[model samples]
Target: MEKKTNAEVQVNMHEEMRRAFSLLSGKWKLEIMWLLNQRLYRFGELRKEIPGITQHMLTAQLRELEADGLVLRTVFAEVPPRVEYEITQKARGLGPTMEALTAWWSEYGQSVPEKPSMRGRKAKAASSKLG
Candidate 1:
């Protein structure tokens, strides 16, 4: 086997990074995945959980995730019918990435200076949508 040239390796890395970023490019997709990691949720619940997210955007994001195989959508057959979305095993594999992000935020938060003028702390962003 032969090693690839540095230029070829760099190109491959760039392409790989682009592909990964493209998958999570949407504003709320990462939030949705993080929420689903905690527990499964229905459509209505998801909408209520994600602040500033319109029903139209939520629906579109969920469908996109489902198509990408990151979100698992299950629909029950009944009179009214029920649908729920959960993170698939593939999505669950993102746990380390999420944990690292949380860790980084913790360190970053600590680096901020405390000032009386700052007032109250910032609020948590709305929980990610489940479905």
Candidate 2:
């Protein structure tokens, strides 16, 4: 077997990290996964759970996750068609890593100052312009 040089190893690692991020990166994807980590949710339920997410955005994000094999979407035929979303085993495998990341954020976020409110900033700007 040929030994990989340090540069080769670094390149491989970088590619792997990129792939992982590509699978998980998005405004709503991680939040969707976090919710599904608890239990299966109906489309409407998920929308309610995630505030400010549009129905269209949720559908798109869920489709992306389903395509990536992180989330499973099931449809049931009935009087009223029902659909549910749940994290796949592949995603469950990420539970520990997600937990660690969440824990780190909990600690780190406390030490960090709160971000300025975008809504407040926008209102202030508008008032300044009017004034």
Winner by lDDT: 2
* Candidate 2 residue lDDT tens string, 1-131: 99988876666877789999999898788889988998999999998888777788899999999999999999999869999999999999989987998999988978988986432112223434453
For model 1, what is the alpha-carbon lDDT of residue 127?
A: 83
Cα RMSD to the true fold for all candidates: 9.2, 6.7
Cα-lDDT of candidate 1? 0.86
Off by over 4 Å in 1: 1-11, 110-131
* Alpha-carbon RMSD, candidate 1: 9.2
TM agreement with the true structure for every prediction: 0.74, 0.77
- Model 2 residue runs over 4 Å out of place are 1-11, 116-131
Error of 2 at 120 (Å): 16
Q: After aligning candidate 2 to the native by TM-score, how far in Å is the CA of 57 from where it should be? A: 0.4
